[model samples]
Target: MKRLLTAALLTLSIAAPNAFAGDTRLELPLQDLIDSPQAKEAGIDGSVRFYLSGQAHPAVVSRMGEDVSNKKTNGVGKSDVESCRWVALSVLKAFQESAKARGANAVVDITSYFKKNEFKSPTNYECYAGNIMSGVALKGTYAKVK
Candidate 1:
């Protein structure tokens, strides 16, 4: 009986090696700051759409939503690099929310204001200022296009 049980277990393991593997979670960095061309081609909704340009559509009804900015003070022992990164993320988040509130699908013409020219990305309009405080600013344009 013991030999039979062992044989059965080994057979199952050999036949289905991945049977014990459940859904695994993997952490990965994502860059979704700009809307993909596929989204534009599919006529994606504005609520879930974001753009790095001033006008989402040239032939659609569009308006300047507003200018939004955010600032964060540096914490103790935090280097300027880290501080600017934190502030830029915070400000961009605020800008996105502000644009959504005003019915803007995307924020365009983004310019970064950073000390000593910090990290650069294809997306975002950032402003880094102040020794104690870092800041970012952006202008959003609300558009409704079919």
Candidate 2:
């Protein structure tokens, strides 16, 4: 009976909803922001292109399989790299919106930040780990060539 109760409790815990369960919508420039008479008067009718990039330090530990030290382990886990990717995507979306707001047709010269750092768990576990930071940056000016 105890085993059954434990199983039931575990199931309930796993099924519980997360505090932040919904996917966030990407922020982009609205047509109204760029299609204003003021924007047209300001010579914002041209296309503007930009690029963005950034990086972040490793902030999580991922362990896979019985041999955490084995580099060839088939375990999959989260890392700072994943976080950076998300950040980059967000930045790119923002840039796109900004360009649109300025009446730019598109962006160019995009790049991303990249690096590797050593990481150790805070719990003082003598485990092997790596850190990575990623970034996105934009370069280009808005012009009214259109």
Candidate 3:
């Protein structure tokens, strides 16, 4: 009887996992994520600046190109906001690395590109937190700035 009950509960949970943990749509501050501890640990610095969509940035001496980072997010024991911040930081680090690889010093015109849907915001970026796996998708252009 105990085994049967456990099995049934498991099936129900698998069928409707969102009922237990709903997806959260968050528009968190772009600067806050960039200033997070994870970003600091990743060595993200002024060496490679990130300018959000619609934000005024230094003139691009050379436009390296644009790219996207759909970084993975593991909730673990942290809340949606916490997980989102970490994921966003990871995405930023990825972009910074790419900028370095491409001989660029800045990642500008950053946007939330979840599912390829561009969500432009000068101050905030979009993150989706889910029961299975949260994520932050960022699209940005790499450039050498003035």
Candidate 4:
């Protein structure tokens, strides 16, 4: 009887936390800052979408000049590389936060993009900036299986 009681208690302890595992949704950018205790208990998985925008000072263009000879002088190319990193990082953070909210342990199928035909010329000078928009979507079930 004691052994049976002990086994029942252990089972309850293990199963209690997983009882609440379910589909979750969230929107935030705090993944790196916090840890989700429920992730393991709830059996979580997730995915993220991201976007970024960037601008380059006139100095960038001036430095390159009209030197068609320079393969790297492409105005748009320079701005995208310079600013996309921060944008991607921010998007990643948002995805993490979403996963935590949804009780997801991790994210998959992550995708990113820059707004097409979304370039604008500086009104005053030759400065240019690129705009990027991103989104994160989570899909999966939460459960602790053996």
Choose 1 or 2, whichever is better by lDDT. 1
Candidate 4 structure quality by residue, lDDT tens digits, 67-141: 000011122333442332233333345444554565444333221222111222211101112232222222222
- Candidate 2 lDDT by residue in tens digits, 14-110: 7543321222222222233345464445444434433211222222132111101111111125343333333433444555456566555444322
How well does each candidate superpose onto the true structure, as a TM-score? 0.45, 0.29, 0.85, 0.27
Worst 10 residues of 1 by lDDT: 21-30
> Which residues of candidate 1, in runs, are more than 4 Å off?
1-61, 113-131, 144-146
Against the reference, the lDDT scores of all candidates come to: 0.46, 0.33, 0.86, 0.29
Task: Using lDDT, give the best candidate's number.
Answer: 3
TM-score, model 3 to reference? 0.85
Model 2's lDDT to the true fold? 0.33
Q: Per-residue lDDT for 1-146 in model 3, tens only?
A: 99999999999878767733437889999887677677788678868999998999899899988999998777768888888888888898899889999999999999999889999999999988877567899999999999
Model 2 clashes, total count: 19
Where does candidate 3 stray beyond 4 Å?
A: 1-13, 16-22
Cα error, candidate 3, residue 64 (Å): 0.8
lDDT of 2 at 24: 23
